[model samples]
Target: MLQIQELVFDAWGRRFFDGASVSIPKDAKVGLVGRNGVGKSTLFKLILGQLTIGGGEIRLPKQARIGSVDQEHPATPVTLLDTVLEADVERARLLSDLETAPPERMGEIYDRLIEIDADRAPSRAAEILSGLGFSNADLARPMAEFSGGWRMRVALAAALFAEPDLLLLDEPTNYLDLEGALWLEARLRKYPHSAVIISHDREILNNSCDHILHLHDGKLDLYVGGYDSFETQRAEKLRLQEATRAKIEAQRAHMQAFVDRFRYKESKARQAQSRLKMIAKLPVISAVLREHTAPFLLPSPERPLAPPLLRLEGVSVGYGGPPILKNLNLRLDLDDRIGLLGVNGAGKSTFAKLVAGALEAESGEMVRSARLRAGWFHQHQIEALDPTDTPLDIIRRIMPEASEAQRRSRLAQFGLGVAKAETTVADLSGGERARLLLNLVAMEAPHLLILDEPTNHLDIDSRRALLDALNDYEGAVILITHDRSLMELVADRLWLAADGTIKPFEGDMEDYARYVVDRARAAARAPSQVAREEPPPPPRAEPPRKAKTPTGPARRRAEAAEAALARATEALAAIDQALLDPDVFAKDPAKAADLGRRREAAQARLAAAEAEWLEAAEAYEAVKEA
Candidate 1:
């Protein structure tokens, strides 16, 4: 068992923890809950011996191995697979001994290798990497090829592969996509090791954790069951406390009234003196104090929005290379609550950039209504703040004409009141900085709000606030996030950006999750192998969109591609009928083989025709718009 007894800690002269004690039994999965900057990470550091404890003791088994996910991973030429495999120090040492050990000592090395499962270590590491959304090709690739977020994934994969006795993960789902997050949750649920995870995602916390550790006001309260159960218990406790407080107040009021009415009376003076003595003997209820749980609701737009706030016509957006989002045609209406779906590098961010006007299309045209006012909130924006500046300083720079009071009031809506507003960004927690970034965007009074992974830094309460605000907002929202609960709550429509095209998705996150997993597993497979696994493309979430009517080449090409698709479909059906005769394979294997080849060729042809049809269909639509 791991135990923290009378743990006392402080930072910058502020006591974050005082006499806090909690015990995590062996194999217990604990969801560490607290507001941002409440010392969850600090406690982890204390356990890791990275921070000096002010008082008390943290006890762990002497043999316990602790593994923690590193926040930052350096860009190195190290192969992704090796990076994960290297996490097992014992395995590395055993393998090294094999190279230098004498012939007689080779037996000892071999025995140690068996103990450590050295032979399967690399393959085990690979399996963990694949579970975290890395493809087979990605395993051999150097870490330097990946972005910072992806490098963090590599770090997580390494920690998971380490398989320590005690695991500490801080917001493990923040860098993952929907499929990856779900996969990680499933893995962690079956993990034999004890874990303490700090996460804003309620689903993950509830699914992966068996216990809840409520850390607040420098105290730790351990609760049984999942996060929902903890909430239920905490709510009931507060309700009862409130009722007791009300009763105490009523009793005190009655007693005071009696004293005030009868204290000076001759005969009743004895009763008044007795009441004062009774009041002195009563226990204090401590005022039922609670940390603020009220949400910081965001303000609505300042001006009415015109319909079709943004439109994309044949937009091809990418870096200085081939387009990631090709010939994209989309429209953002006043009521659009589009949840954009895609993998990490699948142009979701590029699409957001196209809508936010942060990146111009490499080709084609994007038209925005003159009345369009867009609020763009991306994770990078939070990191872009000047750390030396206070919230007041930042807002003053954004709105110099507004008075100090006005600035503070505006910031207060997003939970930065007078005291918090004056706090320097350098002293603020990551979640606070994230909120300040949103507050800055809210001040723009945007007609369209485009948020990309907005809940990554927020606590559960703040995420709830954001979902409520988005639900009640008058303007449209273009949301790109892996928060399934938020997406399910906020999104009225879903836009799927897959296979270099964008279209309305008619299903929910559940359906999208299955699709993502299917896609990821098949990503490294050749088309023929994928065809064998899945004979046809998955069913569309919605009915097939109508083909646009166009003049000239686009129209002609679309028609020709559709005809080709029909022919390919017909030929495949014929091949299927021919192959259906079991007698054919029994009578002549040569004929069966010939039919199989024909079927394969037909499938290849049909796939090509389908691709051409989709391309031509997009072109036809683009031309019609032109």
Candidate 2:
């Protein structure tokens, strides 16, 4: 168990943790969450001993190992798989000692190696890397060959593979794609040791963690269950606190009224003194003051555009060289909310650029309305902001004709008040910059809005605010984000960028999640397999003649039953895949137990679907015979 008692930490010009205390039980998966700039990362630093506390104690078991991914692993000659394996210091030490130790002592080292299951370390490392979006062929490559982001993933994979007693992860999904994030959610759920994860992804917090450690008002409060449960519990707690405080205030007021009325009278002086004493003894309860999140301002377009605001026909686009995306045929309406999904290098950004008009198609026809206006907000815009420029300055350039007061008011509506309006971009928080750009792009009420990873810096509440704005906006949206919750809630249609082309995904987010997991599992098994390509859109055929298809309720019932059976079979297969892993139980018993429960549920669903399908089939056959 990790115990933090009366932790007091003072930082530059302010206190971060003031008498904050929380005890995390062993093997607990805790989600550490708070608003942006709330010192969540600072707490991790303190726990890691990078920062000293002002007062109080943080205790851990003796000789307990703590692991964190602070930065990208160094670029070296070591292979990716070997680098991860080296993270296990005990195993590495044992191997080194085996080289020099006497023959008799070698037996002990070998036994220890067997105990740790060191022989399976390579496969374990490869599996972790594959889950994080690494190709199997990349495992044997030198670390120096990979980029910084890939190296960061390697660092995270190393930490996870080590399985330290206390695992501290700070926004692990920031560097991952949606598929990688989903895989991580499953991986963290079954992690063997205790983990304190700092993440803003709601799905992971709700599905992967068993507890939430909320840091607010310089205090730590542990809540059972996930983020949703935390929100409900915290709300009720504040409500009760407010009620108790109101009651206390009323009693104090009543007693004070008596004292004020009778303090100087000769007959009631003693009674007044007693009343004053009673007032003093009343328990103090402070009123709960909830923090308000600034609202995101996304104005709707004044006039709606006709259907098919943008269209592409056999379009291909890229930089100056070979085309990155080819043979694209897609249509977007003024009201369409397109959620673009793909792995890191699956040409998602290329598609976004093509749609946003940043890059013209090299071949084929692209059509758009003559009056079409597109508001494009990409991550690079934030990175490209001038550090010395203030929000007021930015708005001034965009709204050159508007008065300074008008500019500031617009900023205020975008969540930047008077205080932050003049602050330089360098001094402003990431969330502030994100909000400024997001609102700025949509200020003109364009016909279509293309946002790429818009919620990377915003907190959960702010993300919700954005979601609300998007839902309210009358214009089209093409959202590219790693946040699954945002994607599922905001996008009405899903598009997959794969095999150098863009195409519609026929399934929802759940089906896509299963495909991603299955793909990763395949990669883990076959290290040399290439990226999967979309099957050639079944060769076009002449329109088929209308056949005597079955009709009536029985046919409809049969169709529904068949769909249910497909879903049930897929669910069961996913569970069976996990159970088939030989190392799952040995690595994470908790996950194994959870999988057992899920397997039973999947089995039950499968059986019900099968029975329903059989009955529906019989009914449909009878109707057809009639």
Candidate 3:
């Protein structure tokens, strides 16, 4: 059993875990969850004894072995299969000794090899690699040849082959395709050892773990069951906590009022004293307020966008090699909401790039409306931003005629306030840069929006906000994400891109999930698997995503519009507070004029933000229900 008692960790002047406690049974699988910066990874390091704890006791069986995926991979000429098989230290060491040892010790080395099951190590590593979407040819390839994403898969395979007593995996699926992710989840389930995982993928957490561990607000909580169970129970628990706090506050208010009224009166002094004592005896309940997620309010299309804004006929695109998506006929309109599903390396990103005009088809007709302005949010675009350029600089260059107010308004729309707008791109976090990129495209008022794995770097709150914003969008959207919740909430229809075919899927996300599971099972049971252990030539690119039934839009614009208004109102309120501050005005006798200038600038932006909300709402309401 693993026990964490009074675990207190302090770093960067913040108490991450203060007197927090949680215990896992001898062989329990735990899903550790928290906000992005909430120390989930830190906790793993603490358990591994790689970092010193501020205070606490972590008790583990002294004889138990631990294995984890490496965060960084050093460049190595070693083949991938050898790298994974080497994870079995005993086998590797014993085999090395056998090569140099005298004949007298031959029997001893053979005995050790037999004991450690060295003969099966290669096959085991091969099976794990194949499951992670690696071809047999990849097994002999040097580790340095693969990209960082594929390298992580090799890391996971090594960890799995190690077969530790306690396995720790942090975001294992972050780099994996859906097929690979599903394969990994099944392996973890069948794992005989204890495991602790940290992931934002809900399906993995739900399916792989029998217990969920949540760390938030400087505390740790362990709940029985999977991710779904944790969410449902946690929601109810929070609701009850809020209700309880409300009642306590009401009682406290009444008692305080009675005491305030009678405390100074001579006749009521005795009664007031008694009331004050009673208040002291009452249990205090701090407000159980849910932390707010980052605000992300996307703008609606103002232009009159026609249906079928983009059409691809017999289009085929890939990265230099043969086409991954071939002979495709697709049409997208302003009102269409599509979610793309596929395995990793299946060309979902390639398809999106083709649609966005970033990459031309090898040989096909591309028809697009003259007025088509597509807003694309892809990781590569975020990467392409000039590090030295500030948010204002980028916007100013793109829209040279835009005024100071217009530039600031556009930046603020994606949650970049005055300070962030002035900061350079190099200093921004991945999520912040993503928002900036999104704002840059949104300013163009695109008729079609394409998002490829937009939620990969975003937090849960930002993801929720993004989903809400996408649903409220009047323009067409093609979304490719691994987040099932986002797909379920935003995608009205499903499109499956697999086996070099792009076609509409005739089911929901749930059905698609079933299909994935079934496919995984079929692959696991396939014969001729042993033949795959040997090197095979490069094969066809993996298949991509699936589509779902469209959920007709309702008054979603109202919610998103309100969110936009709230953010605008908050920005205006900050300006008002700054303008009203005596300290700010007193900084110089001439500061009042400066303050007035700032206020005027802010008011113009506020007006623009308001105008956008009203216009979007009007357009949303005008859509006739068919």
Candidate 4:
């Protein structure tokens, strides 16, 4: 368990979190919810001891273990199993040493070895990897071979394999597909350790977290239950706050009127002074709540789309090989909210590009309706932006017809202040760049919007804003995203791209997920039937066993290695504990430096033990199999 007391974080003379205090209960699953730029990730980093707090304290219990997914993992040519097992390398070394220990000292080390092995179980690592959608065969695959999404999975597996008492996850599900996201949700819901997750996926937060911490306007507001419940309660609380403010204003006005009338009277002078003091003591109500300023503006269509916005006839799209989308025929009508779903490396993006006219199909004809003007928003389209142009300049260029006031107003709607808008496009964050692209596209007022992974870099608020805009738009939308909740909210029909075909399903995203899960199950079961029909491999000849026992000096050397490995394992555990100590890293930078040095020392020891263990194991195996 951990508690943050009067925490304040400031940067460049601006306060991000001001006097925020909250407690994380033991084994509790908590969600950090807020708009973009409200410091959700900042708060997570503060708790993880990755950021220094400007004021107050973060109190964590002693000897607690913590694990987190690094936002960026180095592209190393290590195997997936090697990366995950790296979480507790010293423990693995210790286990190998125990396995090769002499029988005489086994009695002395047995109890300690049992305790260490229980804390570092390889089966737990395997289970976490499998649950996160990795196959047994994938364990030996190099990490460098995986894409960004799969690499994120590897990072998550490493965190989970550490088996920390508290896990701090920042946007953990950003790269996860629906299947992997669901698996993670299930795991977190029943997880024994506590977790504080900062995620934009509403479904994940709702399904996995029991409590919600809403950080808004430099304050932390705690709520019981998940996202949906939090929404309901927050709305009620805001309503009451508004009502109280109104009553206070009325009373203040009445009292002011009384004072104005009686100030001239000598007999009522003392009473008037008392009323003035009482009125001054009254709390000042905020003129506008943060939620009131939210952008509810929807995208307005400049012209009505024709009956059929887009039509594909006998479309065959592919690369150098055979067609991935073969003979696809479909018509997209105006006001259609179509959700495109498929597995990784499928033709979803290809189909989207073909529809957007960004790519030419291998064969067949495509048609766009006469009145259908299209605006395309791709995940990588930010590269098209001029790095020299500021966000404000880009907006002005894109919407040249708009006045200066209108450009600034629109930019502010997407969470960019006047100062931030003046910053160069090259200096903007990934999320900021995405929002700018969206703003540009929205200003075009096209009759059809083609978005491929538009939610990639957006936080929860920006996503909701985009979703709301898409939902209210009078134009047709063809969206390709892995976010199921966004699909459910904004999509009316499902278009599944798989097996070199684009199949249409008439249902919501929930139904689509269910259909996919059922199909995956059926597909998984088919391999067993084929295996049963095939003949098994022939048995190999047995190897001869070893006859002699170990010598005295060899036994002593093994015992010494085992003792060193045990010490290394303990040091690794200490490093894990140090990583979670916010007081050390946030309050005392020197202590953090010392902890880092010790961690490096422990890692060196672990590597040495691993080398010794491998050499000893090789020798033992050669003798036993001789």
Candidate 5:
């Protein structure tokens, strides 16, 4: 369905695709795998015509439709169900044409609509939305009422509903919870059209994809079967390559030695010359370079904590209003590895906070050993990092009594080398920032570790490294993540947060996945029963959003803030691109240092611009509300 021949693309002072070529079979689900800095996303853009190729060609059928979710769906007045149903352009057009068409044309339109199963579009769209964590009530809600993240889900739902010939998804599971991720995995496996997904989630790649497309060192290698099979195939191919190169090198060396030994002899002169020529014609094989994954440092506690380190009896907790988690009775031992499962907004973070001592229980009894120490690491910690702050700066603050050398050494142990130690957080990749925070949180060797969505930013290899570190660390763990593979491998038991309470899950990860899929399917079927009881309202009859715009000072401030944010964002991207150069630090340390300083300044500007934008936007919304 999709083909690329010697495709070449270069931008931002580097080559992303250097004669990279691959073919995707029709209706094949392929996973694009690569390191963080690799050009997987760029490949998607090139295929989408958002980026021009420097050479060669990318080909698809003449009328092939391509679909991708570039950003969140726009906030509008359309009902969620109608928004997705409208994604079927052909169906929408035919239905619209039926309003004013002649009798002959009306028959054609109706026939086409029937062919496309237009009547079932609503049910299908609702199923997609339900699998993505939207409730049945959300179907009738205006798009303007949802948050940005929810809108992104709606965009994904639209793409899936349309079922274009070729679908491109970049980290589709990033915005989804574990339940949603599970549903998506099963959905992708049965997708009728071809799909190319860029995802670091192992379970998705293994379960959803039929093939793996690996991007490495400016080349693409297509492997048959899932991620595990791809790994095995790649390893064997490298081994064969190395063996061939060694044999060729030995032949060349022997020929050269023969030429050197017999060049002066009269009888052997012709033979020597012939050997030299033969040696010159020998093929040159480059050595394969294996990529390295930096190790994560998670130290174990100096002394083991007492068993039952934490116990809760009828514990209830909440911010101020009703309790998000009520009457929770649980116990944590020194050696337990507990996997916490829940959907978004399901009190998982609240439970983590309560255990981390960031929150106090509102009622009931909660007990903890006096010397118990807990290390909490969540995705929010990475978001809350100061853009201008460097690993060096952060380490210095934490180790005030230590010397500069000690601080640098500590940062190094956390996988931040000398070059990255002084670089600002804004210049670091998501994986780097995640690694720094993960190690920092576990630096003191707490008896218990509470990790939430820890693998969201990490690549497959980095995630494996983290899994290894977690396994080696001799401490109790409470792991909350959407990554099924990691959770299954790390956790010895399972706990689920649902229905405003926490309880022990009866079965394993596989059972949980089945349950989630079944639940979503049941929810999707529920809306139809309700429709039978009461007449369904037309989506178009729903109220539209109020058409109000900010005026005078509010409008002016918002426009200025938006402009400033654009400038700041562009400046930061340029600096980030420069810093991403592989030889930036090696070839010109001085230039790298200058870029680092500029990036720090740019980050500060970006932060200020974002804050101003948020304030202005809120004020403008307030005016509209008034």
Candidate 6:
């Protein structure tokens, strides 16, 4: 357990926190949330002792451990496992040294080894590494060989493997694939240690955290539950706070009027003075507004175009292989809100590029409607922005015909005020750049929008703004995003690119997720059939064991075969009953149908069991005759 008491942090002459106090209980999963530049990361550093607190104290229990993963990593030649295992190298070394020490020194060294080994065990290390989605092969690979994303995972694995009493993870899921992210969520849910994590992914926070900690304007705001609960509660609180502020202002006005009317009257003067004192003692309630403002805009003209805004006719695209996307024929309707989804390196981006006309298909035609107007936002939009251009200049450059007032209004709609619009694009943060790009794209009024990982570097509010704008836009959207919640919010259809094939999913994300889970479960159970096909284990070895009642082994074997046959028959019957259950049948028709077929197969298996039983019986009888 860790407690931060009256902690204050300041950076670059700006106060991030002023006497913010919070306690992280044992095994607590806490989400640190706030708008960008609100010092979530700075607070994390204070907890980890990386930065000195300006005032007050951060208390940790004696012998408490802490781990943190930052946004950057130092370049090192260490392997992934090497970096992780280094957490307890001293303990491991002590144990190793004790193993070879002389007998005369063994007693003292053995005690020391026990003391050191208690803090870290090899099994625990392996479990943490596996839980973080690092394979044995990955652990052996050099850290320098991995991408920045994988290196981030390496850092995360190191933190998790340390088994710290308190863990501070900063955007831990930023670079993870969907599967890795899910694995981390499950691991953190079951983690015995406490954690404070800052992440933009809503689903991760919702599924993993028990509490929400909102950092706003140098104040720590605590919420009882996860992200959704915090949002709902925070909204209500803001509403109430606004109402209270309004009432307080109204009372102050009435008091001022009474003072103005009664200041000259001696009898009323005392009452007026009392009212003044009361007003002075009253706590000033400054209403803290939500960071994001609702975007005000009329829906753009949605002129109906012909069907198939863009069509990929037998498109094949890849770098240097058979093809990452091979001979894919796909069509996008004007009303389609398609989400591009796949694992890393599965060509989701490549498919998006083909659709956007940014890259050419290797062997097939990418056709678009003659009237189609397209806007594309790539993942690296920040890098794509002109460094010399200010946000205002960029807008002017993109839309030469737009008046200054129109440009200012467009910028304001994306949360960029007049002052911020004057700031250079080079100086903006990743989230700001994303917002600017969104604003620029909105002004173009394209009939089709192609965004490749638009939510890549956006915070929660920026993502919400983008999603809202996209939802309200009447354009066909091809969105490639790793944010599952964002996809669910904006995507009306799912397109899965896997193993060089594009599969269309006609249902919502929940249904797609269920289908994926079922497939994964089916794959996991595939080996069960092979195990079942193998012969049973050999009879237990015995050195001429005395048979019960002097019975021969053959008779015992016949009884064992009959028992096995009866067990199989009973199992088949149970399966039949389960398949016929109305609730089960209704909830999952496919599972029920599969089970029904399995029942027929089980009947055949039962018949085979009976045949085997009869053969065993015959063989036993022959043995007895001999």
Best by lDDT: 5
Score residue 436 of candidate 1 by CA lDDT: 78
Query: What ranges in model 4 sit over 4 Å off?
Result: 88-94, 99-137, 248-288, 292-308, 311-314, 327-329, 364-372, 399-421, 442-444, 505-508, 512-626
Q: Is candidate 4 or candidate 5 better by TM-score?
A: 5
Candidate 1: tens digits of C-alpha lDDT, residues 167-190: 999889988986578677777888
Q: What is residue 164's positional error in candidate 6, in angstroms?
A: 1.5
lDDT of each: 0.79, 0.87, 0.77, 0.73, 0.88, 0.72
* lDDT of residue 540 for candidate 1: 49
lDDT of 4 by residue, 508-567 (tens): 556555554443343244422222111112222221213323232233244456667877
| lDDT (tens digit, per residue) of candidate 6 on 1-626 | 77778888888989988988877777889999998888988887777778998998889899888888775445578776667777665565666877788888878876886776644454455445544445445556677777777677767877776668888888876676554565577678877788888989898789889999999878887787889999999978986787678668767877888998998899999999998987887778997665654452324546868776777767788876678888687777766677876656777778777776677778888788888777788757778778778888877877689899998777787778978888887778878787677656656577778887777678887677666666556767888776778887777567776657676755666655544433333323432222211121232222221231212334445666787798889879768767655755765689888888888888988898899899879987776565
Full-model lDDT, candidate 6: 0.72
Q: Which model scores highest in TM-score?
A: 2
lDDT of 5 by residue, 119-223 (tens): 888888888988888877889999999999999999999999999999999999888888889999999999999999999998999999999999988999888
Residue 170 in model 1: lDDT: 88
| Candidate 1 accuracy as TM-score | 0.76
- Which runs in model 5 stand beyond 4 Å of their true positions? 264-266, 528-626
TM-score of 3: 0.76
Q: What digit string (tens of lDDT, one per residue) describes model 3 on residues 331-450? A: 776667888877676678888888888888887887888878888888788878899989989888887997999888877767888999999999887778887776667766677889
Better of 1 and 6 by TM-score: 1
lDDT of 3 at 453: 77
Tell me the number of clashing residue pairs for each predicted model: 0, 0, 12, 0, 0, 0
> What stretches of model 2 exceed 4 Å from their correct place?
529-626
For each candidate in turn, give its C-alpha RMSD to the true structure in angstroms. 20.5, 14.1, 10.7, 24.4, 19.0, 21.1
Weakest lDDT window of 10 consecutive positions for candidate 6: 530-539
